[model samples]
Target: MSATRTFLMELHCEEIPARFLTPLWENFVHLLEDKLEAWFPTGDSANYRKNAIDNSTGLYSPRKLAWRLVGLPAVQPDQTETQVGPPQRMCVGEDGKPTIQGLKFAEKWGMDFSAVRFEQPAGKKEPCAVVTLTKQGRPTVDLLAEALPGLIAGLHVPKAMRWGNSEFEFVRPIRNILCLFGDQVVPITVDGVTATNTTWGHRLYHREHPAPVVIATPGVYESALETAGVAVSVEARRTRIAQQLETLAAEVKGRVVADAELLDTLAEIVEFPKIVRGDFPADFLELPKEVLVTSLREHQKSFCIEGPDGALLPCFLTAANRTDDPAGFVKAGNEWVLKARLYDARFFFAEDRKHPLSDRLEKLMALTFQRELGSYHDKTGRVVALVKHFASRMSDDTDHIDRALEAARMAKCDLRTLMVGEFPELQGIMGGEYLRHEGAHEEVWMAVKEHYRPVGADDAIPGTPLGCLLSLCDKLDTVAGCFAVGLIPSGSKDPLALRRAGQGIVRILWERGWAFPPADLIAAALRVVGAKATKPTAETNEALMDFFRDRVAYQLELAGYAGSVRRSALAAGWEDLVDLKARCEALSAFAEDTRFASLAQSAKRIGNILKDEAPSTDFDDSLLAQPVEKVLAACLMKLELAPDQASLLHALANLAGPLEAFFNAVMVKCEDPALRAARLSLLHRLRQAFLRVADFSLWQ
Candidate 1:
C-alpha cells in the first residue's frame, strides 16, 4: 500500500444538455465508490490513497461532466475457498446403512456417495454422518474488472442519441474514457473510449489544448479544474449560483423566488457560473403572470425576482458560462431570449381569447380520447350522468350538484384550445380560467378546475363539496370506461393511468367523509357501463367486477386493514361503499376480543363438517327431539331478527350459546340415517342464521 494523496482527473466532450449533467455525475461517483468497496472492504478509508477517476463523471452542462473518486484501494484481499455437502443427521439413521433422505441430499450437493462415514456407539439410540466441506472466494482483481464494466454500462441518459457506426447509447457522443487506480491506469475500455490516467478541462477555454490532464489523486481534481476555468463539483457550482443570485437580488432591493427546480437547472447549465441580472420591458408585465414567468424561466433558464410583498418584478437573474465580459454581453443575450418568448406568449393569449370556452367544447367533440372507447365528448356525457347519480346519493346541496354537472360537461373543452393544446398539463386549469372569463357561475367555474383534482398520489383533492363530487364522478368514468374496453392496468404498466384515476376516487372518498361502499360505486358504474356497452356477457362483466374488486382490496390492505378483517366484512355482503367500511370496522373490533376468535373458530369448524351437506330449506321443530337441537331452536326464537346494528349484535349473541352447546353435545355425522339427517338439518339451520351476519367460510 502507498501513502494516500489527492488525485485530479477530467473528461472533455462536445456540448451536452444542462439537465443531463447532474444525474450522470451523481451516478458515476456512486458506481465508483460501490465498485471500490466491493473490491476492498477493510482498507476503504485507511490503506487506499486519494485518486481521481473522471472529473465530470457525466456532468455535462450542454458540454461535459465527469467524476473524481478519491481514496481508492491499491490492491484487493487474498482469496479463500470453501465447499460443503449434506447435513449430518440425514446421512445416517439409527443402525445406519445410509438413509434414503441422505442419498437425495448428497445428490443435490453433487457429492460422491462413497465419501459418507457413519459413527456409532454400542449404547447409542441413533447414529449420523458428517459431510466434509470447502469454501472459496474469488480473486478481487478479476471481480473488479468484471463488475466495473457492468456498473458503468448501467449509466444512462434521460433520453439517448445515436451517432456514427457504433450501437452504444449516451446523452451525446462518447469521445473518451479515463480510468485510474492511484497513479496506475486501470487498462479498461468501454463504448470505444479507453481508460487512461489523463483527462481534459474547460473545452472552450482550452480549445487548442487537447492533451489529457494527468491527475494523481482526487483532492487535486476540483482545484485543478478551478485553475483550468471549470467547476468540477456540481454542488459547488449550485452553491455559487445560489449565492450569486441572492447577492444580485439584494442589490436590486428584491428577493429571488429561489425555485429549487430552476436552481437545479441553472446548476447543470454552467461549469463556471456567473450570475447576470437583466430587466425586461415594463409593458410586457401586462402579459398574464404565468406567461411572464414561463417566458423567463423556460426560454432563458432565469429566476424571477419578486418585490417584498410577493409580486413579480420586471427584472430576471440568469447564470452564464463565465464572467468573461462581466456586463453587456450576457445581459443583452438573455433579454433578447426573454423578449422572443414573451412576444410569442402574448400573441397566443390574445388569439385564444377570441373564442369562448363553450365554443371550444363544441369543436372538442371531434377529438377521440380512445379509439374504441369513444371521444372526449362522449366521456363528458358519462361524467355528467355519473355526477348526477353521485349527487342523488348525497344529502348535501342540489344547487352545487347542478353546477358540478355543468362543470363536468365543459371540463374537456380546453382540449380544443390553442393554448392548452400546446401545454397539456394546464388542461383543467385552463378550463376554469376560460370559464371565469366567460362570466359563468362561480361554482361552475370552480368545479371545472377541481374536477381534475388529485392528478397524482400527493396532489390535493377538490376542497369544495361540489368539486369533490365532480372529481369522483370524472375519475370513476375513466376507470369504468377503461375496464369496459379491456384496457385495464397491469403491473407497472398503466397505459391509460386508470390506476391513478382509481386512487383519486379512493382519496376523494376518504377526504370528504363519503364512506360509500367501493363495491356499490363499482356496481353503479358497471350499471352505467352495462347500458353503454354494446358487447355483453356474464364472463366479461365478471372480469370487470373482479378488476374493481382487486383494486378495492388493494386499497383497503394498503390502508392497513388485516386480510382476515377484509374477508370477514366482504363476506358479510356489504355492497354500499360506506356500509362496507362500517362492517370492516365492526369486524376489526370484534376480532380483537378473545371470545370472537373462539366463536369464529366454532363457525369455521361447523362449516367444515357440514361442508358436504346441502343447507336445509325447512327448520322443522320436530327435529328438536335431540337436546342440542331443542336448545338451539329455542335460542334462535328468543333473538330478535334485526338486520342492522342492534339486530346484528342480538343475532350474533344468540348463536354463541347454541353454537357452543351443539359442538359440545352433538356429533353431526352420526351412523344412523334418520338421526344423522335430523342433526345435519339442525346444523344447516345454524349456518343459515349465521350467514345473516357473515359467511364464515370466506375467512379460510
Candidate 2:
C-alpha cells in the first residue's frame, strides 16, 4: 500500500497582466493533470473516478497561480525485472560454481555471485544465468522536484518575453517558486528562482504585517494565506467582489451592471477585493449609456450602476486591492478619474452631434478600411447597392427597400465621428444616435442601430426586416471584399472575421424567414466589388459560395442535423439556407424509416452503375425490354415531388417496389451495348428525382 500525502505549489511572479493570469493558470493545470496522471495513475480507479478534482486543482490571483492536491502517493511502487546472461554449461565450469562471465554479470547488477542463479531449459538441456533486480520506489518529493520545473517552463502566454538575459520566456518574470509536500520543501527551480516552503502574502499587506507566511503543511496553505490578507480561491474572490458590489449598490439605490467578461477581468486584477462606490456629476448621465459604461469598464475597470428605473446613475463601483480607504482619499481619487473621463465623453458627444452623418462621408475616404479593398467610403456604396439588390429578392415594399438603402449609406459614416473615434465600440450605436438627432426616418435609425446584431454566436438577430436587410448587406460586402483581395480565411486565421460575417448572414435570413438564397446576391456583390479586385471574379465567387455553404452546414449541425443529412444537403447544392435546412431536416426524418434504407441502398447502387457514363433521361421507352424497366420508366415520368418532406418521400416510396424488383431481376450489364446504356439511363432518371431534395447516396 502507498502512503498518500497532500501537495502544494505556488508560482509567485511580478504582477502578471490580468488577462494572461486566468489562461496561464488554466493551461498549466491542464498540463499538470495529464502529466501527473500518466506518471502516477491511481490503481484505485473507483476513488480516482469519484473525486477527480481532488487529484489536481488550481486557483489564481493577480500575482499568483497555485494548486493543492490530495491523495497523492508518497512514492512510486517497487518494481523488479530480470536480465539473462551466459549459459550454465559455461557457468558450472569446473567446480560446479559460477564462471568468470557469470561472476561479471553478478557484479554488473550489484548482486552476490551466489545469488546469480541459473535457469534450466527443458528441451535443449541448456542453462543460462539470470539476475533478478529490484528497483526501490522513488520519493514523491524527488519525482515532483523533476516534474514541477519542466511544467513551469512549459507554461506559455500569447506574448512571451525573456527577462534578465535568460533564455526562458514567459508573460512576466518569475520572482519566487514555492513547492511543498506535507511539511517538506520540494527542491525545484524555475527561471533562476528556487522553490521554498515560505511564501509572502499580499504585496502591500506584507509591508505592515511584515512576517513571512510559512506553509507548515500543504493542507493549511490556503488558510494561512487568508490570515495574511491574501485570497487563494479564484472563485471565492470573485464571489466576494460581487457580493460587495451588490452591498454598495443597495446603499446608493442602484444595481451594478457588468458583463461576465468584465467581472472575470476584475477578479483576476485583484487578490483582496475592496469595493468603492464613487459618484460623478448627474449631468454626465445625458451621455449615451454605452459611452458611460465603456468609459468606466474599459478605462477604470469599474462597473456602471443603473438605478431602479433603468436609468444610468451618477455613481459606479470599482474593485480596489486595498482593504481600507481611510479618510476617503482613494474614493475621492476614483471620483476624480471618472469625472475627467465623463467630461471627455460629454465633449465628444456634443461636438459630434453638431454635424449630420452625411458631412462625414468625404472624411471616410481618407481613412482606409482595408488597403486592398479601398475605403469605408467605398464599402458604404457597395453595401447600399447590395442591400437594394437583396431587398428586391425579399419584399415588394419599396418604402422598406428605400429605407434600407439609406441606412446602409449612413451606417459606417459614424466611423469618422469624434465620439466614435474615442469610443470605437460605439460605431453603429452612435450612427443611429446621430441620425435620430438629425430627424432621419425612424426605420433608418432602427436599421443603423441593429445592423451589427447577432455579433457573436448567441447574439440576437435584428427585430425588423430593414435591420435584417442592412445587416446582411453589410456582412456580404465584407465577405466579398475579403475574397476580392484574395484574403479568404484559412485554418484558424480569420483576420477580417469572415466566418462571423458568414454566420451573421445565415442567422438573419434564417431567423427572418427569408427563403431567398444568398448565392445570387453574393455573385452580384462580386460584380459590385470584383471589377478592380486583384483576384478574378469567377474565382472569388466560387470561394464565397463555398464559404457560405460551410457556414450553412455548421449552422445545421448546431441545430442537431446528422452529418449524413448535412452531406446530402451539401450534395444537393446550397441555393437557399432556409430551403437547404428544411431539406436536411426532412431527409433526417425520412431516413428514420426501415424501408428508407433499401431506397438509400438502391440510390447508392444507381450512383455506382452510372459513375462514368452520362446516362440521359431521354432514353426511349421501346428500349425497356423487361416489365420492371417499363414500370420504373413510367413511374419516373409521372413522379411529381413537392418541396415538403412527406410528399417527396411518399412519391419516392411508390417506386421502391419496382426498384427492388428491377435490381433483383434485371442484369444491368447485358452483353448488348445499347441494352446496357438503356438500363444505365433508367437509373439516371431515378437519381435525378432524389437529387431534387438531396443526393440520397449520402444517406448510404
Candidate 3:
C-alpha cells in the first residue's frame, strides 16, 4: 500500500439559480463523501473520518462548487479471495487422476488444471475441493473516475437542462471540471468536458495577471483562489455581506431586516461581497410592510431596513457582483426598478380598496377551491360552521362565538382582491387591512389576519382566542375537503400540505391543553364536508380520524415521548389528543417507579396466561378454592377510577401486590374444572383494571 494524501474537485458551470446552488452543492458533496469512504478506507481514515466526511466545509459560490478531502488512499488495499467448487471425490476419478469435471471447471474458471487442487474437510470423511481467485483491487483514481460523475448525477435538482449538442443533463451548463488527486489530474469526461487540475476564478473580478490559476495542491486551494479574487467559503462571504449590511443600516439609525433564507440566497448569488444602498419614494411605505418587503426582497434580491421603533425605512440594500460601481450605476438601476414596483403596488392597493373586501365575496364563486369541493364561497360557509363548533368548546360567550363565525365568513374573501392577486403572500394581511378600512371590530379583523398564523412548525400560533378558533376551523375544513375527495397524502407525498395542517392541529391542541375530543370535532367537520361533498361521506370520517391518530403518534414521538409510552396510550384508543398525552405522561412516570417492574412483569404474565384460556368477565366466588383468589377479587371489586389519570394510576398502584401474590400462589390451570374457571375469571378481572391505562403487556 502507498501513502495517503488529499484529493480536490471543483466544478464550474453556467450561473446556477440562487435557490438551486446550495442544495445542489450539498447533495453532490454528500453523495461524493459516501463514495470516498466506501472506496478508500485507508489506514489514516480511521482517525480523521469525522473531519473528512461530516465537518469539512463545502465551498460554493455562484457558478462554482469545490471540495478538498484529506487522508485519501491512492489505491484500494489488496484482498484475499476464496472460491469453493465441487467435492474432491467428484473432481478426481477412481484412478486418482483429474476427471472431465475437473478439466471443465478449470476451463470455465480460466485457470490451469493443476491449479485446481483438493483440500481436506475438518469434520467430513470425504475431502472437499476449492479454488481461489485473486481479485486485484483497482487504483483509487480509477474508481473515482467511474463513481464521481454518477454521484454528481445523483444530486437532487428540480429539473435538468440540455445545452448545446451534449446528451448529458445537469442543473446548468458545464464549463469546467477541476479534479486533482495529490496534485495529479484524475482525468475523466463528463458531457464532452474533461477534468483537469486547472481552475478559473471570478470571470471579471480579478486584477491579477491571469484568471486560469493552477492549484499546485489540494491543501492550498483557498489561498490560490484568494489571489484570483474569489471568496470560495460561503460562511466567510455571508459574514462579510452581513457585516456590510449592518454598517450601512446603522448609518440611517436602522437595522437590516433580512431572513435566513434571503441571506442564504444572496450568499449563493455572488462570488464577491458588494452591497449598495438604494432608496424609493416615501409614499411606498404607506403600503403594508409585507408588500414593500416582498417587492424588494422577492424579485430584487435586496434587504429591507427597519427603524428602531419597528417602522420600515425608505432605504434598501442590494448585493452587487462587482465591487467597483463607478458613477453609482447599480444603485441608480436598483432605485429605478424599485420605484416602478412600488408604483404598481400603490395602484393595486388603491384599486383593491375602492369597493371594500366585502364586495369580493360574491366574486369568489367564479374561483373554485377544488373541482368537486365547490367554490371558496361554499368553503367559507363550512368554515363558519366549524368555527362555531370549535369556539363553543372553549368559551360559552355569545360574542366570541359570533366573532369567530364572522371572521371565518371573511377568511377567503381576500383571494379575490387585486393586491392579493399580485402578491399572494399578503392574502390575510390585506383582508384585515381592508376590514379595518371599513371600520370593523378589532377582534373580527385580527382573527381574519391571523387565521393562517402558523404555516410551519417555526411559525407562531394565533395570539387571540378568536384567531385560534378560526385557524383550527380553516385547517380542519381544508383537511376534510381533501379527504372527502380522496386527496389523502401518501408516503412522502403531501401535495396539499395536509401534514403541516395536521401537525399544526396537534401542536395547538397539545400546547393549549384545550378540552376537546378530536373524534367529535373530526365527525363534526365531516358533517359539514358531507353536506357539500360530491361523494358519499360514509368512509371519509373514519379515514380522517385514522390519519389523525397516525399524526398524533408522530407528534408525540417528536416531543420526546418514549415509544412505549405512546403505544400504551394509543392502546386505549385515540379519541382526544390532550387526554392521550396526559395518560401517556402518567403511565411513563409510573413505569419509572421501583414497584412498577414487578407489576409490569405480573401484568405481562397475566396476558400470556390468558392467551389460551377463554375469557370470562363473571367472577364466581362460590367456586373459589384458594385464599389468594378471594383477596384478588375483593381488591378488584373495590377498585374505583377517578376523573384524572393520576387518580386512576394511584388506584391501579394498590392492586400490584395482591395481583402479584395471586399469580405466585394460585395455579390458574388447575386440574378441577370449577377451580380453573374461577382462577381464569380472577385473572380476567385483573386484566380489565390494567387496560384502563393501556395494554400493559404491550409496554413490556
Which candidate has the top score in TM-score? Answer: 3
Off by over 4 Å in 1: 1-143, 146-162, 165-171, 204-212, 226-264, 267-269, 272-277, 294-297, 305-310, 323-325, 395-398, 527-700
Weakest 10 consecutive residues of candidate 3 by summed lDDT: 41-50
2 or 3, greater by lDDT: 2
Expressed as tens digits, the lDDT of each residue in 1-700 for candidate 1 is 5333332233456777765676777776777666655455454433362233433344344555555455443344443323343445766668856678778756765676666555553555555443455434343334545665676667776888768888877777766665544555556666778767656666665776666666665556557667777886677888899999999998989999867888888877777888988988888777655566666776788888888987788899998787464558888988887888777867777777798888876676699877766788877877788888878778577776777678878888878876666566667777887788789898888788767888876678887877888888888877776676667777889878888788788767755668666666666676666655544535545765666566566656765777777776666664455666666665665655555555677778878888867756565677556677688766665543555653564456556767787788877787866667767776676666666556655654
For model 2, the local distance difference test gives: 0.81
Clashing pairs in 3: none
What local distance difference test score does each model get? Answer: 0.68, 0.81, 0.80
The runs of at least 3 residues in candidate 2 whose Cα sits more than 4 Å from the true structure, single-residue gaps closed, are: 1-6, 37-58, 77-137, 161-168, 243-254, 307-309, 323-327, 395-398, 562-564, 587-606, 613-643, 646-700
Task: Arrange candidates by TM-score, descending.
Answer: 3, 2, 1
Count of backbone clashes for each model? 39, 1, 0
